[model samples]
Target chain A: MRRIVVKVWEFPVRLVHWTNFLAILVLCATGAYIHWPFLSTPTTAFPYVMGWMRLAHFVAGWALLAGLLVRLYWGLVGNRYARIGTFFPYLTRQGRKSFLGVLRYYALLSPRLPPHLGHNALALTVYSGIFAVMAFQVVSGFALLGQADPSGTTYLLTGWIFSFVSNGWVRFAHYAATFVMGAFLIAHVYAMWVSDLAERDGTSGSLFSGYKYGELEEFEDFGPRPR
Target chain B: MAHDPHNPRETALEQYLESRGVDRRSFLKFCTAVTATLALPASFARKVAAAVAADDRPSVIWLHLQECTGDTESFLRASRPTAAEVILDYLSVDYHETIMAAAGHQVEEVRRHTMEQYKGKYIAVVEGGIPTKDGGVYGCIGGHSMVDVVTEVCGNAAATICVGTCSAYGGIQAAAPNPTGAVGVGELLPSIPLVNLPGCPLNAPNLTATIVHFLTFGTLPRTDSLKRPLFAYGKRIHDNCERRAHFDAGQFVERWGDPGHRQGWCLYKMGCKGPATSHNCPQVRWNDGLGWPVGQGHGCVGCSEPGFWDTMGPLYERLPNVPGFGVETTATKVGLGIMAATAAGVAVHGVAKSIQLRAVEKKEGN
Candidate 1:
């Protein structure tokens, strides 16, 4: 058969995705070190290992926040596939039907893979949940970081968090979120690889090249008849 | 017992302090210390002095219920210009259940008389949690339930002060499987203007300074959402810790009796709750600036925080278990366990999928 190359992921979305991925990687490392500093420097004087770790964590956190904000903004103005509405797979009847179909495919009850331009319904739901977790981390991260300098503007903004729960519980939530994101990362990558191998539709390369190979009929969802 | 408000010379505090040989200069110095302790500037010392020397000293009624008397003991042990002497000389402590000379019917009579005499003018200092289960039968004083007594006493009180962790946030008595259903004073009397000076054994200076703040300004000191004075509970213990430099340097004492512990390194890894706990144990230093829990090489138990016994426990562990699991499990353990299980499940699923794929390919070949 014939295959149609379609633009799925926009440049901005891909850029934010890559940047967020890097930020989360650094954040996990630095956050763990700060919580439990496994490494001990011979001299307590010169390097300030924990200080650098915390600084890196905070900088990466802010960077992630900036990328998230930009991506959310782009979700408003980008192509149909990049729209925020696509993330909520249960919002439409077609999307819901596709979700069930994808679920059956994962359960090994169905051998056929559903055709789609961007993310499948199941992937959309999972990514949406991951975004929610990321948002929680950003909020709680700032709350924990602001505590270091209580007199600063950040503290003023987030200090009320303590009134609701103690700092210990807040730190616990942040740590728990890391593990959640970690688990998501593992499952997400594995699923992506499996999908790329099984479908052979340039799924993995689409993230880098911003295009996916699909059946001609699938292109009809983009609106208007293709010449 | 009403005294002239116009004449400072007629005040009982001046006469009492003067009789104890506490000079005017020494009294002023005490006021200055109190002012500083309250996080007030140097100029507020004069206002404090004048307030203390005023003709009307506020009467105080101290109630002890369901407690170990540790708060009273700590109050007596307060040094650094000696809070016991200053507090005794300053306030008209008419009804203290522990220290009062009068006892039995006479003491009860005096308590009644004093409560009536100084109604809406005295400070009610509650020192322990009040049991509410079974009509508060778990705790009582002089044939009155703790709940009834607190409600009655605090009803007419100008303000109420919860002087220890028990009275502040139910402390250990309200820990898991709280059979007695003990609760903090705030929970009992939510409408009362209450101040919590929470600690395992209440910090004496906080009580003294709070009283002085009232004596000076005729109002309670500014408090946090927990009803704790901001000057004492304004910052986390970790922020002002002596070994904070070691914390920032990524140096930690991994275990007790380790080289790091010997060298006085950070105790964060040893489950020091200092980072989460807010108190002035580092700056105020228990026993007249001599030492504190961290200074003496032990982690802070976070006794001042609400539900600490229930929430901040496994004392030496980094994190407490998530509640309502019917089993004790730390957040890290649960989180990492789930992640491991997911990874294992993913691998199993992947293997199964590859087997199914090979079977499909074989079927196609046939």
Candidate 2:
């Protein structure tokens, strides 16, 4: 089978990913404070903590928006595999099968894994789901942030939602969603660690190196499919 | 007890008092107290005196149905004239089941006789809910359904005063499934002018006020659709709560018996339903104006409100959770980022694997 592989993501994309990861961790810790404020540290003692947390959240939000824009542009202008369609596998029947093929391979249900030169169908599906959730978080977070800034667009849209849902219920939903995200992060890390340990095919390193092994003959004989 | 021989029209009150043995000064004092309770000026006190001094003290039929006698307790402790004779002297309480010495047929006969003689002119003060379940079998007095008796008398009476939550809004007994199908007086007869005093054992002044308003104005005062006097049940307890300053400051009592609890902080976190419940109890108070629930280190459970038993209970708990935007929490956003990164990671790995396969394929081709 022929294999085709090419460089797609630039250094900016990788830097944004790692930076976002650290930002998320810091945000979660500070966010727990904002929600329950477990610290016996009086508001006077660390008056700046809540303020800093808010500042950090705003900065991170802007960074995330920037990252999303850059990623979208790259999807259009970058290599064949870097195209937006590659990240969305359920759009096509062949793409959907390849997505399932990746699941089967990971589950050890198949002896011969589907050879791919880009994101596997399962990975594509996950990316799509992530995109959807991030969009939702952005909307919800902005709405919350708007509470303090009545003049802000986020506040305007979300303020209406708050009134409709009531303030207490809105606050509770924000809390529950936070816990859900926390659980997802734990599971995600565990899965990554397991995959890296078992496969060891530069699973994590490929993020930095931005290139991977591909068969030239396979590229000629068979079209590129998700790994 | 002797009639003032000057006003010959005062003979009925005089004869009734002579038989019951209520003194004259105490009767005038009770009229003055009722006038004051009605929030009427001292000038109106003379009107009350004139009414009492007249021959006809309006006949009253006090009925108790499915209730805990809370209204009776409130009226007994009415704190105005400071003498039991005061209340007994003003009104010719012709029939009252709980306080009247007459038994079974005798009380029933008195009720019937009063209804027949005074009928459209008498005041019907109902102190409990009327259960209509299974043809009103849940409650009865003298083998007659209280519902039947209430309908018969209330339909013909000049005015009706529902004295407590049970009679006013069906109270605790009408909660949830409402097995007894209990209902208030206004619900049973839409045409009659019924004033509701909807406390768990309503404020005595409200009852007294309605009576005085009727006696003075010849009609009940304008009331809300719930039949509650707007003067008493208009504002929420939260608006007048003593710890309202703490609530405005966002200070809350996190749990029962906490330091904040001892300090008498806001009980919003402990499920004080005062913010949503309207009543004058916080201002008027209970036990002759000594204290109320909030004053006695307990949250206001909103007992005076409709469906309070279900809506405001597990009384010492926090309000239900509400969803808000995360200023601090962004697990969903972060998770999405992580998943995206992971996807990119998978893509990189796939490309690397492809490169390796390409090199192997070129060697085989060569």
lDDT of 1 by residue, A62-92 (tens): 9999999999999999988888999997999
* Cα displacement (Å) at residue B345, model 1: 3.3
**DockQ of each candidate relative to the true complex:** 0.60, 0.06
lDDT tens digits, residue span B1-366, model 1: 233457556556665665666656677777888788899999988898887677677788888988998988885664443534565535645888777878888887887887899899988998888899999999878899999999999888998989889999887889978889989999988989889999988777788888888887778899877888988988889889999988888888988999999999999989999988889888877676688899999999898989998777768878766777645677767878888988998898788777776677688884
What lDDT is reached at residue B100 by model 1? 82
Clashing pairs in 1: none
Q: Interface RMSD (C-alpha) of each candidate?
A: 1.9, 9.0
Q: How does chain B of model 1 score on TM-score? A: 0.89
Tens digits of per-residue lDDT, candidate 2, B26-122, equal 6666677666555568788778766545654578888898999987887676444432334443563688876777788987898899899987999
**Where does model 2 sit among the CAPRI classes?**
incorrect
Error of 2 at B348 (Å): 17
